[model samples]
Target: MSDAVKRLAIRDRIAVLDVLRGLAILLILLMNIPAMGNLESARIDVTGWTAADQMATWLQRVIFAGTQRGMLELLFGAGMLIMASRAMQPDGPVAVADAYYRRNLWLVVFGLAHALLFMWWGEILFPYGLAALLIFQFRTLAPRTLMGIGLVVLLASGHWFGTQQYNARQQLLHDAPAALAIKAEGNPLSDDQSATVKRWEDLQASTKGTGKETQEERTGRTTTLAAFFKWNAKFWMGFTSDLLVLIIFEASATMLIGAALFKWGIIQGKRSARFYLALMLCAYAVAIPMRVIDTQQYMTLALDPRPGWITYQISRLAMTLGHLALVNLAISTGVGRWLLKPFEAAGRLPLSVYFGQSIICLWILFPPYGFGLWGKFGMAGMTAIAVGVIAFQVIVANLWLRWFENGPFEWLWKSLAYAKLQPFRKTPSAIHITAPI
Candidate 1:
């Protein structure tokens, strides 16, 4: 189809999708809390010696291990399609494309600021913004064509990521003891002292796991933009490369599927309940056990990093696919309805909640500012904090949405995109927020 001649498909109002987004938001926070603590410390903590730590570690293994990012990517893709369907008209493909791209470009700006200034270099928005540019070109594609492209992307990314993980495992095994040995030979006081306290104060930004700083020198008050870019360029490239492949693939596939489902009348009440039930059963039966076994084995492998690279990749890929299927089914079924209320409310204000969690965690763990609980908190403690955070966010989100048309960040993003203020406070008559069905 000629791009200009092609039409944009409109969307059915699906509250469940927002709930799904909410779930993604919450799960991401759960996955991130541990990592957030690590970012504060600037060093990796691998010891799960205690019972609670072990259980929390295992839970993280089973839930997030690889699936959290994958699921979030899927959700983002789905969200793109949904947003496009809403903002675009059948005969107005160009308008839709423009608006969508503009939204993403702004996100890139947000991500860059978040990464450099906020010191959360682990942010995914930049890559996603980049990928969205590519995906936007596919707006005019047939549903099937989009799905095919998504599958190809997913397969390519999975293979690429698996290979990288394999290499990383080998390097870590080789480097761990050597690095430890270097520490032992250093000056007694310097070798024994942890640089974490110093690193956090210097950066004021929590980065990836705790810091040892012997290998990499701390960038002090004199950190130049050029130097920051040099460090960030490598950091982002390495960071995104690991997950980008998976992100692109799962994201594309789930998005295409979502688009297809919406097109096929399934999302708009076009499909039979019976068909959805069958899909749910098939997805659950296959996905749950596959995830369970893969996670258990993954943990086993993490503890004993001697396995062949090829074997680990195969296991991870298999489980990743299962996780995708499970998530799809969850969304497809009416089950997502139960989760949608708070989630949609939360997602409507995603930025406020997303960055809010980071700020909250920073207060809890950053030394000299708050509790200084970085390496001290066990896995259970982290999970407990995450749960508490999630509960608090839900309450906050609901209350915020009752009076506001969009969450705080969502309003800001919209205003930025539109080049002026969009609606924020809900009018009495417009109090009912409706997703277009």
Candidate 2:
């Protein structure tokens, strides 16, 4: 077969991969949902919540937050390997890097637009683009070397983040006595605070940052814009510098592992039940509980660094490693595969699905939007709503993919990336399913 045909044709289990991706989507929501405070408050700190709220926060942090992002990172790494392998056959590393880099660049544009247009700021695509740009230059690196780089980046990033958090906490605590006391009353916002909050909300509602200079002009001319940049810069650093360093490292490692798995035929549904079962046992048995312990301990002192910060930081690494192990086990087990099926198709178009979810969520919660249900939905209610949202997404994903090759946003981004239109709708003739089922 020609190279183009080969590039277009590879034996991949769409069902299995999709399912895993879907689970990731749901798990991400599980992890992030609590970050949205209840109806009255725009904060996500569910620290001192009670009963259902407390249980939800703790359980989610332990199970979903600890494990889900790692799984996604691994999957992304695996995907890179798959793409890299395909790009390598005819030309060389340079060719593969070029193709992937273009894809990532497009992804960055999409992410920036998505973040500005939608209310969600925790977009992963932006950093993934940055990582891809850097990693593309190292396409020829030995896998071991790549892993080392990933580790170094991960550790350095973690140290930076932890240190920043430590310092920030100290400062917050130093200022807290007065700030907390003043804000401790039933009404959390001061008169000035309430006005500032309202103005910010109004700005967010109206600004999508699409028109060339319109949004920028408005923001540039106002004090709110300055405040926005200041607050946002800090927010970006927290995630990008610290948390993302770990996430990126984990992703790079997982990608290498995925490449190895593909080469060895494990990801092609070729691994034996025994191997998978063993993987599950090893990863879950020793990892999950340890992660749970670490997460609770870490969260307990997140706002205010405690005396045992050093020990807690060490434990966080342990927890992260445990989560990685769990994700590996999950990949091996048929459970993740089965659980992910409905959402997998959607995950293929992550940009679309993620943004769609944001639109729905914001419409539901934002005051100027639909139901205005943010702070009102307590732990149980939000949990239920989140579940409901997932179910809806599954239905939507299934319906959309049945007729379309790419999700709406996915098609747009890909079209822009390639500088040409590609297939979007799945016609009967265009659909290609392997035979001998």
Full-model lDDT for every candidate:
0.57, 0.55
Q: In candidate 1, what residue range of length 10 has the lowest lDDT sum? A: 213-222
Tens digits of per-residue lDDT, candidate 2, 199-256, equal: 4344333333233233342232233434434433444455466566555554554444
TM agreement with the true structure for every prediction: 0.72, 0.71
Superposed model 2: Cα runs more than 4 Å off: 1-15, 36-48, 89-95, 139-145, 163-270, 298-340, 432-437
lDDT of 2 at 42: 25
Local accuracy of candidate 1 as per-residue lDDT tens digits, 301-390 = 333333333333334334444544444445555654444456667755667777777667644443324565544566788888889889
* Candidate maximizing lDDT: 1
